[model samples]
Target: MPSLELDRYLGTWYQLAAVPQFFNLVCARDTMATYALDPQGNVSVRNRCTTWMGTPNEISGTATVNDRVTGAQLHVSFPGVPTQESLEGPTNYIVTALGDDYSWALVTDPSRLSGFVLSRTPALNEAQWQQIRTAIEAAGQSQCMYLTSPTTGGLSGIAPLCTV
Candidate 1:
């Protein structure tokens, strides 16, 4: 399968939804992600959020493109924490799909075991969401496990999976 193109992939992206991950557990509102080139030429990640009770939190990290042949693959770690405090295992971040206008993206991991749907806007239309769902399934991931993005009212309703 083709990997995500790096240059075209850099920019601010809104988190549409994702599986529950440790790093994001405390994030309760308006979560978003931004990617940029660092001084050393690595991908920089900025994740921001608001607590459930309305406190703001932010984290910054740097990611290295694992395979230039497939720039879609990356290994990321937070800069705020010491290397010893980094994740015990490397997190695989793979880009499975990209929007035609670079307005949205579908990201899965190496095993297609976990993933997220992101966009430039807080909400996505049925068509765009369906496209993400299709890509997730085709990649062998479980769409049923996808939780709702808090961007849409703080996760009150169940996240409906797209049916073919």
Candidate 2:
């Protein structure tokens, strides 16, 4: 499969849903991620969230587009963390589908090992949901887990359903 276009993929994007990371454990109200061009032209990330204590938490990181044409892989590092390490190895950001106006996007790893549904806004439409679902299936990641993002207008009452 081809990769996503890097330039078009850059910019601030709201996290619709993710696999749930340790850093976001205290997120209670809202969580957002912003991507911008860094000084070296790499991708800079700023992740913000409202903590359970009602305090704001923000982390800064940087990302490098692995493949220019495919924009499929990236290596992210948190400068604030010890040793400035990355959470994961070079992960693939396979572009599954994109919104007509580039308002939303569905991306997965090359192996379909992980996935995320991102949008310009916190919420997405039914059409967008279906599109993501289709993309997930197409990527052979139907067994992957789906997270509950209450801050993004998703259900928080129940646990996520893992197909695997």
**Predicted model with the maximum TM-score:** 1
Candidate 1 CA-lDDT value: 0.75
1-164 per-residue lDDT for model 2 (tens digits): 36565677777776666655566678775677788888888888888877889899999988777666766667678865764476455654556778767788766766665666677777777777777767666667662465645554644432452421
Candidate 1 worst ten-residue window by lDDT: 155-164
TM-score of each: 0.84, 0.77
Displacement of the residue 25 alpha carbon in candidate 1, Å: 1.3
lDDT of 1 by residue, 45-129 (tens): 8889877778988988878877678687778787566551353345478788877777778888877767788888887777777
Which segments of candidate 2 are over 4 A away from where they belong? 1-3, 80-89, 92-96, 110-113, 152-164
Model 2 accuracy (lDDT, Cα): 0.68
lDDT of 1 at 109: 83
Candidate 2: residue 140 lDDT (0-100): 74
Candidate 2 to truth, TM: 0.77
